[model samples]
Each structure stands twice: as structure tokens, then as C-alpha cells.
Target: MGKVTGFLEFERLEEGYEPVEQRLKSYKEFVIGLTPAEAKIQGARCMDCGTPFCNNGCPVNNIIPDFNDLVYKQDWQNAITVLHSTNNFPEFTGRICPAPCEAACVINVNGDAVGIKSIEHAIIDKAWAEGWVQPQPAAVKTGKKVAIVGGGPAGLAAAQQLARAGHDVTVFEKNDKVGGLLRYGIPDFKMDKSHIDRRMAQLAAEGVVFRTNVVVGEWPQGSKVTNWAKEQVSAESLKAEFDAIVLTGGSEQSRDLPVPGRDLAGIHFAMELLPQQNRVNHGGQVENAISATGKHVIVIGGGDTGSDCVGTSNRHGALSVTQFEVMPQPPVEENRPLTWPYWPMKLRTSSSHEEGCVREFAISTKEFIGENGKVTGLKTVRVEFKDGKLVEVPGSEQDYKADLVLLAMGFVNPVASVLESFGVSKDARGNAKATTEAEGGYKTNVAKVFTAGDMRRGQSLVVWAIREGRQAARAVDEFLMGATSLPR
Candidate 1:
């Protein structure tokens, strides 16, 4: 609950961004968080709804109302406490989460909702500045060892919880560092990697062991997932060494568009383009890294990955950037009454889109056109939906110039070979087969083995990964001790 009339008195204030010209020069974060006073004002806008859908809307079930009330009272210390109660990483969610909680806010029915994400961003930033964040090592050791494969949000969250529950935890990652996708896939301009480095320090202080550059299972050839492993550990070895094993290695198999001229030079998966830039930003060398400079870049796919490509291309001093989507363009605004308190399909323009982009919907890439061995253009076709299926329209074929093409079509599943090595069953969608029931959540068919995050669910949000990680940790605890006090 907040001030009774606060929602009516104040308009929603969004976090500011640095000027485009200045931001394009570097990979640092550009978001300007709200001041303490400003955050308090936004928090006061939380209406006292009997049923708080904002909690249900959030994957982590963050105590949104309590935190808002705390911020309104200028109790920044307790605000972080309430925030960290359900969610482990408010900094990550506050910066990158889409804020479905705001969509579910009661005031959003007919007016702008409280700036929940901005308030959260401000609270966490202030908490870190005030030296409030500290490691919480368990009081007693359980002597149960857990091997967590993958160091993304899911594995990190699970490792922290298991360690807090007094279990010895070791996180295995193939990359040279922790933070999985957060370490590589996401652009630094959106969120600096320093956030992850600080969290890793906290985890280490809490008695969690991190083993980077170590692969848990086999990595298939030509995969897009980053691998810097100098050593490999087998599933059998982990099962023999640890009391329990959790697979949080995300779904990394990038989806491909196989069509004519698919093998042309200057065409690549978005992963190949994104992770290299991230490495270069961190002082690593990318020998033959793909560059968008002075090139006509065409990004395929209209999801967040495509948007990332657009922003990256612009940052690389690209000549022009264009994005294509197979689906019809959504309306600029959604019909709230028809789809309130849930994620609705509507046009969403990310900050990357604001930098500059030409977006085309209801379009399909017919074929990649090439000159010599490199991509020169793309043959495209406009299409319409008929009986809920895509159908090409006659006389809509068009050719567009493209010097470089980046496919951001999203991921299909986790690499199957890795799952096969563990003998873990897979769902129809190719994700590891596991239930979320408290009785048997995250348990794979193999004994002493569990799965969570994108490895179990398909490619999903980082918030969802954190939620699964926390829940899986509880499940592992319950299995180990026959009862668990950790939050689900």
C-alpha cells in the first residue's frame, strides 16, 4: 500500500538515457537511475490493490508492494531486504527485465503504472553504494556437495541458495568466467559486466566455489555457445564426486534459417557477432570477429536478440540497419481491458530501436544473394496470414542491398549431445525433461542428477532462470535432508 492519492498526483517517470552520440562511443551502461527522492515519489504511486497481480506477474514473485511501501517511507535499507527476500539479483532484473510487474499493476488499467523497475534500479544501486550488500555464509555446514553445471543466473542462484543451506557447491562453466549469458550474450552497453563481477565476489565470500573454463559435458562442433574450457568433466565423474548435480547450462543451440545461399560469407548467427564484441570490450582478442562498420546490416528476427543486433550494429558505426519479422506488425498500443494483468502482444520499441532502425514486419527472407563469396543483398518477399498460416503474396518479391546479415532467430534447444552424455531424457521441444513439483522438481531420470533453467525450460528470460534456480535449490535440499527451509 502507498499514499492513497499518490497514483493520481504523480505521473510515471522513466529512467533517463545518455544522448545517443555520447553512448555510441563506448560499451558502458547509459541508464541514469532515479534519485532517492524521485524513487520515493514513484514508489508512492503503488495503489492498494486487494489482489496484487504484480507479484504473480513477476517470475520471482518479488514482494513489489512491500518494497514500494518501504521506498515511499525512505527506508532504503529494508527495501533491499524485502527485494532480496524472494529474488536474489534485483540489480540484474531491475536493469534488463521487461517489467511484466508494471503491466500487472492495478493503476495500469487506464493510466500509467508506477515506475516499478526504475524504483528497483534506484534501490539496488543505492544499497550497493551504501555498502549494504554482504555475503551470508551459512552458520553450519551440511557437508553435502553439489555440482552445478553452468554459471548463468540459474546456476548462480542455485549455488548461492545451496551454499546458504550449508551445502558445499561448485559451479562449472565452460566460459573463461561466470555469468553465462549475462557474461557474454548480453551487450555491455545494456549492463556493465562489473555488476556480475561484484556478485561473483559475494558468492565466493559465501563459500561457493567457481570453476570456470571447465566443461561438464561434451560440446558439439560448430556450436554458437561460448567455450573457453581447457578441461572437461564427465557426468559420471560428477555423479561419483558430488552428492547431487544440477544442470543449469542454458539452451544454447541457436536457431538457423536454412535457405538458398545460406553459406555465403558475411552472414552469421547473432551469437557469433554479440559474444565477440563483449570479449573485445573485456580486453580479449577476437581474431576474425565479424564487424558491422560501414556495412549495410540486415538483422533477421524481430525479438530482443534482433534488437540487440540493431544496437550493436549502430554502435559499430554501421552504414544502415534494418530488421525483418515474419509475423504481422502488432498495434502500437494494446487493448488493456481485453488483456490486462498479463503480457500482451503489442509493438515494443527497445532503447536499441531508438538509436536508429528500419523495422519491417510481415516480411520473409526468400534467399541470400551473394556476389563472389560474400553477401551482397537479400531477396525478400512480403506475405500475409491466411487461416493462421503464413502465405506469400503474389508480386511482392523485392530485393534489398545487404553487405552483412545477422540471424537472430532465437535458440531451438540445449545442445542435445550434452544432454545425451548425461542420459537425461528430453521433452518434445528438446529441453531436459523434468517436473517442477516440490516432491520431485528438477530431478532428471538419472540418479543424483537434476536440471533447471533454460536447460529444462526452453529459452526464456533471465528472471525465469533465477526463479527456476531458486526453486531447484530447494528441491535439492529437500532431497538431501528430506526437508528444506529455503524459500521456493
Candidate 2:
């Protein structure tokens, strides 16, 4: 601990944000990070709590206390060194993670938790500025070949570890770039693509080959999985060529709302709308790109994707934006005694929601009203839970005006074709079946094949994906050489 009484003297300081009016005009990150002095103060807030729950709370198991102590002592270089030891990409998580580690902070039991995410953001940004973030190429070549499918956070993390372990690693991506969901699913306003770009440069320098615009399996025809791949590489080719294969392909099956007007022109899955916006930002064009400009828009599903839709709609200058959540709104404040030291359920208003949005909770859409093959409005009803069953209110049925509707109700599983092509059996939830045990972790039913991230565990946080990727990399390395030097 840097300061004995720092927690008593200091309150949590969050990172600053650009004004709504100024930031809404463009698709750029508007967060103002903390200065070095401010970060030192935040780091000092970390008490000498005997048990560091924040480390276990973090998906990547970051050494939070060490980094806090380093930052407090003004040892900026060592701060990043400790950070990178467990987490491969602090910059990505620092910017976008919801900070479950903060929830698990021991200080949070009685006061505001230490600003760990903000401190991490500061540390990584500083490391980059000082040119401390550099390529760590392997000292010797192991002469083994590895193929990583999908280039999202998980895939990238696995690739970096395998490459640094002296394996010939090649990442196969279906998009025009390496970042899977990070590059396309997330809007640029949340995190600019430059972060992924610089990391790609570092990975390439570390001898990780990236094969972009290459699909490892057949993309279902007329699917809305948001692929920009130009070429298809057979699964057989990868199996025969690579010494080991890791499936980091993300959950791409967008759950659909099979209502009456699902065939309407203006109704679409969130993936279709989100990726197009990212493509546009990258100086690419989408044929008949879905636009929310000047139209009454409705976003279904109250998750992160739905909030993103609200933000994008606001940026697009929509007439009105409304979001629907089938579940009732959670308490604004959680019952800390019941849920402390773990992620708590509470009302979460994203920066996008703060921008502007009408949020409807405990509501469900019944039907989509349309005219001339295009959506015009929605029929809805208030809902309540009785005996754990959802029941619609008898008199609450109504219609609301809407021209564009985006379904953001999360993904169900990875594209089945990719898993089937590898002959990998699926779990009950359709995710690739691979245990997380150290002895046979990430190994699929098929020999020489492994799975990680969303492909194995279903859709989850980016931090969890990164953790799985790193663990899977070690699993593959050990399987190849009978022992792995890479960190667990």
C-alpha cells in the first residue's frame, strides 16, 4: 500500500467524458484519461487488504495490488510490466470492460472502490507514449505450426502467446481486418480501431502471420453474421497443414425475434446495423447500408448491444429512440451485503443512454406493424412475472410508432458451419465442447483441435475471452511439447 490512510482521504475519481453535443457530431472516442498525478492518487487508494479480491474478480487475474503500488511509487514502467504479465491487452479492457474488479474491491464494501480501470487506462496509455509497449519476439523457433481461427480479443491473445512461445502462428479472419468483434461488432465511438491496428503491428512484428479476409469454413448463404471475407479456406486444409488448431471463432448467431413482421424491410439484427457503421467509419461502403437518420427507431433487448444502438441512432440523428427490455428494471442501488465481491445487478445507464433514449422495462413486443413491406410501428404489452412465468397485462396492449427496429438480443452460438466443418461436437447450448481442466483444457473431440473464448463458453465479456485465449494458448503449447513455459 502506498498510503495508509489514502482511502479515507480520497474519493474515487472517474475518467472524464466529452460533452454530449460535441461528441455526438462525430464517431470518435471522447474519454479524457487521467493525468499521471491523478492516476497516482487513484492508485494510492488501494489499501493493504490481506486478500486481493480484485485480482480474482478480474477475468485475466491481473495483479491489481502490484500495479497500484507501482503506480503510487511513480514507477510507471513497472506498472505496465506488472499489468502485461497477466493481461495481454490492458488497453482494450481498460476502455470497454465494465470493471467487475471494481465491484469485487474490498473497499467497495463501505465506500467507492479504487479506480482500477482508470488507473489501468492511464498506465497503458503512458506505456505507449513512452515507447515501452514493444514487440517481444521469441528467442528461439520451436518449428511447430499453429492456426488460430477468428481474430477477436481471444484469438489475438492466443496468437500472441503461441507466437511468443516460438510457434509459427497464423490467424485466419473472415473480416477485412484481424479484430473480430472488437473491429466490427463494437462501434468506433466506443473504441477507435487504431488500438487494434497498433496491436496488429506488434503481433506481426512478433512473427504472427495474419490472413485477413479468409474464412475457415462456409459462411451460410444470406446470413447476417457480418462477414466481409472474400475467400474461403477449407477446414481440411487447416487441419492438414497446421500442427494444432484453436477455434476462437465468436458466437455469431444473432438471436432473432420471430414476430409477425420479421420480414419487414426496416427490421434487422443488431449485427447488420452495427458492422455497417464500423465499415463506413473505416472508409468502406456497405450496399444499402441501414440508416437510422430521421426515423422513429426502436431497439429491442436492453443489453450492451441495445445501448450501442441507442448511441449510434443518436449519432445518426434519429427522430426518436426507444429501447425495450423484457425484464424489469433492477434497483438503482444493489443490496451490497447480498452481492458484494461479485458483479451486482442494478440499473446501468451507458454513455449512450445518457446521450438520449426512452427505456422501457418489463415490456415485450407482440407484433410489428408494417406497410408496403416496411415497418411502421410496434404492438406491445406490459409484462409481469408470476410463479416464475411471464404474464402479459390484460389491458396494457398498445402500439407505438417506429420506422426502424434493431434486434440486439445477444447471440446464441457460433456459426454452426465452422464447428461442423471441424467435426467438433457441440454442447447443449451449441457452443464448442472443450473442458477447462489443465490436463486436457481446450481440447476438442477431434485430435489436434482446440476451442476457446465464446466458441467454448458462449457469449461473454471481452476480458473473459482474453482469459480463455491465453489459457488455451498454454494448453496447446503443452500439448505440443509435453510441457509449456507460457504463464497460466
Candidate 3:
């Protein structure tokens, strides 16, 4: 606590955003971060509760109060250190994470919660601007070798930790660069790719080797690929080379709507559309890229991915945009007392929606209409919830014109070939069969193999991915050295 009554003295201040009209002209990050003074005041709002539920609330278990006090007292360097003690990348989480910590804040019980995410964002950004962030290479080599598949957050976090433990670590990415979904799935307008680039530099300086454009599984002819390895390497070869392997590949299989006109030319998955723009941003050529420019676009599935589609379409100069959600809209305000310290069901309007979007709830697409094998419009119907089940209304059907349709229904599981190649077992949900037990956590039935992240737990937040990566690294270290000092 900076002052005895700091929480009472200071009012909450949130970060500002660029005007929607101006931001819609281009695909770029628009949320402005807090300044030093503003962040300090926000830090003062932390209650320093006897039992900080915020720690348990955050998937990464960040030390909230300690860092808050540090920032309030002008010890920014130490604040960053405290933050890095638990979280591997606050910058990534600060921008994209949904901030479950705020929901768990004690101040949230009566008034506005402490802006923990904003303070974190400020601290890390300041550390980078001051050139305080550096690579901490291990002083001695353990002579242990580790191999990581997939360059997503989970794999990257595990690789970074393992490298710091003095193990010879190598990361394999099928694409031309690192960051699995973070690189391609997420639109750069929310988080620029430069964040990943800077972290890549740090990881490289810390002795982690990266090999991109090398698909681990079988690549069939005519398969979409950025680049290829001169000599293909099999799962058996990887097992032979490294002492241990961690399968942290994300869930890549997208759920599809098998309605009529499924083979229409203009209908595509959100992954197919989002990745093309990322490729263009990376200076790669994409022939006839999918654009909503001057076209009426309809995005099915109302989630983060769908919101991303909405943002991207607006930036592409779309004539009109509409989003569909199968479930009925939630209440604008949550029941605070009932949902305290837990995530509540409520309506969340993202900045992308503000840019320009017609959000429709309790709507179902009946069919896709096409002409000349190209999608032209969709037939839809309204529905209502009854006894916890949705029932379509008989006479509430409608039609809407659309040139582009993006399926953002979310992923099902990782590519089956990747897991099958390793002979790893899968859970009922099609994820890698593994537990988080400290004694035998992340260990696969196959010798010296482990799994984590979406590969192990299915689709989840980036913060949880980092937590799994750190824990999986600890488990791998213990398996190799009989014991380890890395945090679980």
C-alpha cells in the first residue's frame, strides 16, 4: 500500500482507444497503453487483501500485490522482475487475455477492481523501452537435449524455460516463422506481429535454436505449405535425436457447418481468411486473397475469432457486416454477488463490434444460396431458448445477401496425423491423453514424450497455454535430470 487510504483516494482510470472511424481505415493496434503516472495511480487501487484471489484468478498465478506496490513506489524495474517471475510474456497476455483477474479482485466486490492488466502492460512496455529486458542464458550446460514441436505459446514457453536450464533445445515450426495460431490465427490489428519478433530475438540470444518451414508429419502433394525441408524428418528420427520431446501443437482442426451449398466457392473457414492477411503483412505473396472489400460479409459464430473477422472485414472496406450467434444474448450486467470471483456470463461488445457490425443472437443459418458455384446469400431463421434447449421459430425465417462467409465455430482438436505419428493416446475430446500431476504430469505412454497446451487440454486462453508450457518444462527437466529447479 503506497498510502493508507490509496484505494479510497484514487479513482479508476482505464486505457483509451483510437476513434473507430480512424482505426477502421487500417489493420493496426489502436488501444493506447497507460502512462507511468496513470499506471501508478491504478496500482494504488490494489487492496493488498490478506488473501489475494487475483493470484488464483490468473491462470499464470502472477504476484499481483507485490508488483502493484512496486509500480506505485516508482520501482518499475523491480516491478517487471516480479511480473516475469511467474508470467513468461505479460505483453501478450496483457493485450489479448480476457482478464479473469479483474473479476476476482476484492475491490470488484463493492467498486471498480484494480487495473492489474493495465499496470502489467505498462511495466513490460516500459522495461522494453528502457532496454531493461535481456536474455539470461544458462551459465553451465546440463548436456541434455530437448525437442519441441509447434511454435505456439505453449511450445515457445517450454522451449524458453528448458533453454534457460542449460539444455540444448530445438523448436520445430511448420510455417516460415514461429508462433502457431498467435502468428496466423489472430489478426495483427489486435496484436502486432512485431511483439513475437522481439521475443524471438530474445529467445535466439538465449541459445534456443529455431527451425521453421519443416513439417514434422507427412506432407502430401498439393498441400498448402510456406516452405519445405530438403530432407524430411520423421517422428522416429526426432525421438532418436533428442532425449525428450514435448508435443505442444495447438488444436488446428476447425469445426464446419455442413449445411447445403457446402462446396460454394466464396465460403471459407476463418483460419483460411485470417492467415492470408497475416501472410500479406509478413511480406509474402497471397494470390487473390479473400477480401470483404465492397462485399456484404456474414460471420457465423460469435466469439473472439468471429470478432476478429468483423474487425478485418471492416478494415477491408466491406459494404456491410453482420455476425451471428446461435445462443441468445446474455444480460448486459452480471449478477455480481452470485458470480463473485468467477467468470460470469454477460454480453461483451469488443472494439471490433464498435467499428461496425450488426450482431444477431439466437439466429441459425438454414441454407447457403449460390449461383455459378459461388455463394450469394443465406437463408436464416430465428430461435428461442426453451427448457435449456434452443427451438427454431416456424415462421421467423429471413434472407440476407452476402459475398463472403467465414466459419469461426472454433477448433475441435490438433491434426490427427501429428499425434498418430508419435503413437500417443488421445482423450475423449480428441486431445492428447495426459495429466497435470506433479509426479507424472504431461508424460505420455511413449517413452520420453510429453504433451501440453491445446494439444493436451483442447482450445483455451493464451495464459493457460503459458502455464501448461512452464509446468511441462519442469516435468521434462525432472524426467531427464532426476530433479529440477524450474518452477512448475
Candidate 4:
């Protein structure tokens, strides 16, 4: 709204990345953010639509047009204030969120949408550089104590909100550090760990106590959530110690491909490979670390996790790399007229895909062929969609060499032991059975125990997790005090 016709005058200016060759040399962030002038031009492109569907498009409901105008006017401090009003962590979302807001832009109906993500990136970076971001500790104590299991985004968000509301909040993580998946599952190249470190400092200053290396469940905990906690604690002990307990653990169980030779030595989950590299990157000791060098790696699953594996493998100097998808390939571009405000189905070639990968769609893994208990190859078949079901074609069989097979087919549910410890009910999908409805929302069958995020809603985006945490905190506050002022 700054220039009135700014949308017509300026075209979209995408963020740039370092060359692939240069980036692969080390594990560092590569995206170069926009300058102040370039960011202002992009912010001016906001049309300030009457409806502002971008608000609905964004999971956190960030005030888009308001911040856009602030940025366009060079009011960077105010711009970041507006941006942080809704989103707890603009820096995290600015770097990795898929930017559904851009898809919901009104101008996108005809031409390009405003670069909302880049503008957000600019605002936050400028805010940090100017020391505008600071802690907001509560002035008085409510004297009520709350315990949060898991130190991921969801748990952290809930902790921050409750702490700011004057509640004594403590976060229990089983790992050597906090940040959940953000600390380990995510590579430093995509987003450095320093962002998490800064947020940890802010949360600490806000009076959130963090207890690491304290597992809440039994063995068989392997995901990032499990790694956050070191030793197990019983549910009875947590219930007796805290006024309220919120379970926000992630779905750490990786889905497996149980085919022939499934127990071979060279096959592993993406979680196992990704976390080792992260520990190494953090200067932690990781004996027998997984590597892709001098190997023909085949990653099963075509989602973001697989793409991450692809990037890591390329960096490891893998001899060859290929990615497999069970579904048919989507069109390069979506029919925008039909899919405009909603996320559309289209071929998404990620930065890792660009690094180097032989992407194959409509392929299904049949079996893992191995020699002397080590993976040597895999049998696959072509697949087609028929009557809303995947039908495998009998004669379209093939085989490929694979020195290492990575299963990145997504997670199933949280580890069962944690839920069992609390006797929490689970939905058909194996996630916690806590409705988001107004009455008893986030409240489990257990009296004082609550659930949110991936633990309650199954696997989802980080933004959605933050939303769940905030909402759950509100619910917990109301349950404890019979009234509350926390935002939903």
C-alpha cells in the first residue's frame, strides 16, 4: 500500500543462495537475505487486500499487510514488533516455512505475490542486529508450577507463554541440549543451530527452567524427541511435582519398509543418519557415524526428510544418489485458478534435489537384496493410481545397486511407552486423543495431564506446533485458575 501501484512496478525478487560447489564444502547456511531497500520494495508490493487471505493462509496468522507497510516505511523495529505479535519465532519460520502466505496473496490471482517471507526475514534480521529482540519476563509470579515434556517448538512455545503469564514453567528434555528436532533432525546448512541457541537464551531469561538428559519414557526412544531426554521419569512423579503437565513430544517413530533382507547392516533410518551428522557438526563425539562417501545411496520417500538426506549425501561425496516416490509424479505447475488460496499438489524440487539426485516417481520398493547381511541392491516395481489405491504393475520390475538404503518415509506416531506411562487415550491414528474443541480442549483422560502438538495432532509443521502449544497453554491456564488472559 506504500506506492499504490507497487505491485505493477516491481517484480518478485527471490532470495539467493551460495553456489552448490561453495556450499557443499561445509555445513553452513547459504541463503543470502535481501537488503533493506530490496526488502522495502518487496513490502510495498503488498496490496492490502480487503479480505487479507494471507492471514488465513499462514498457520500463525501473522499480520501481513501491517508489517509490510511498516517495512516499506523503513520502520524496521515496528515491523518486527508486528511480526512477533502473532509468531513467537519469526526467524525460524522466515528461513524454512513453505510460505503458504504467498500462495494466498490476492495479487497472486493475476500476477506475482508479495515476497512475504523475505520481508519477514529482513525484519527479524534487522531487529536482531539493532538489539530490538529482548526477553519479556513476568513482573509478578502466579506461584503455579507447570511441567512440559519435550523441548521442541510446541513445548517451548507453551513454556514461554505460560512463563510470561507468571506461571513457574519447567521444560524437561532427555537430550544433552534442547530444541528437539530443530537441534538435531534439521541440518545446520538449512538453518544453523545458533537461532535455537538465541531463543533458548531468551526463554531462560523469561524464567523457563530447562532440565536436559531426563527421559520421560522407557527404552526404544530414537527420534529427536527421545534424544532430548536422557533418563526416564515416571508419570506419577511428574503429576505429584507440578501443578499441571503438558505432553508435547513429537512423533518419533519412523515408518519402515519391511521387505526381504530388511534387517541388513547397510540399511538405516534417516533419523539415525541425520542426527549423527548434527552431533558431529556440534563437535560432539559420534563413533561409527553414518557416511555416504564411496557409496551408491538410495533414499525411499520423496518428502522434505528425503530431500535432506539427498543434500547430506551429496555433501558426503556419495558416488551416486537416487530418490524414490511411490506416487505418480505431479505436474510441474499447479492450476492456480483452481488451487489459489490453498496448498496445491505440484512437483516440488527442493534445494537438495537441485544438488544432485535421480528422482523417480511411481516407484515402489519390493525388496532389499543383500550379500552376507549387508545391503547390495533393491527390487522395485512401477505403480499407478487406480480407484484411489496404488496398484502395482506386475511386469514393470527393476533393480538398482544400493550400498546404503535410507528410509525417509515419514513418522507413524509417538513412541508408545510415553503415552502408556500416563495411560493416555489415543485416536485411531495412534496420536493422543485430545480434541481441540472448546470444552476440555487439550485435556486428556488423565485428570491434570494435557497434550498438544505432534503428540496430540500427529505429525505436522513447526508453525502448527506453535499454534497448538499456544492454544494448549491457554487451555491449561483456564483449567488451573478457572479463568485466564493467555492468547489462544
Report per-prediction Cα RMSD to one decimal.
Answer: 1.0, 1.0, 1.3, 1.6
Note the residue pairs that clash in candidate 4.
Answer: 173-228, 173-229, 174-228, 174-229, 174-230, 175-228, 175-229, 213-230, 214-230, 215-231
Each prediction's TM-score versus the true structure: 0.99, 0.99, 0.98, 0.97
Per-residue accuracy of model 4 over 1-488 as CA lDDT, tens digit each: 68788888899999999999999898999999999999999988988578999999998899999999989999998898899888888888898888899999998887888999999998998999999999999998999999999899999999999999999999988789898888878888988999999999999999999998998856563555453445778888998999999999999889999888899999999999998899899889877889899999999999989999999999999999999999899999888899999887889998888888999999999999998989999999999988999999989999999999999999999878789898999999899889998788999999989999999988888888888998899999998889989877
Q: Rank the candidates by lDDT, best first.
A: 2, 1, 3, 4
Q: In model 3, which regions exceed 4 Å deviation?
A: 219-222, 226-231
Candidate 1 residue lDDT tens string, 325-421: 9999999899999889999899999999999999999999999999899999999999999998999999999999999999999999997888998
lDDT of 2 by residue, 135-185 (tens): 999999999999999999999999999999999999998888888889988
Q: Give lDDT tens digits, candidate 3, residues 1-488.
A: 66657889998898889999888877788999999999989888887588999999999999999999999998999999999999888889988999999999988887888999999999999999999889999999999999999899999999999999999999998888899888998889888999999999999999999998788866556666534344456999999999999999999889999999878988989998999898897788888799899999999999999999999999999999999999999999888899989987999999999989999999999999999999999999999988888999899999989999999999999887788889999999899999999998999989999999999999999999999999999999999999999997
lDDT value, candidate 2, whole model: 0.94
C-alpha local distance difference test of each model: 0.93, 0.94, 0.91, 0.90
Off by over 4 Å in 2: 224-227
- State candidate 2's TM-score: 0.99
Error of 2 at 151 (Å): 0.6
Error of 2 at 296 (Å): 0.7
Looking at model 1, residue 487 earns an lDDT score of: 98
lDDT of model 4, residue 157: 92
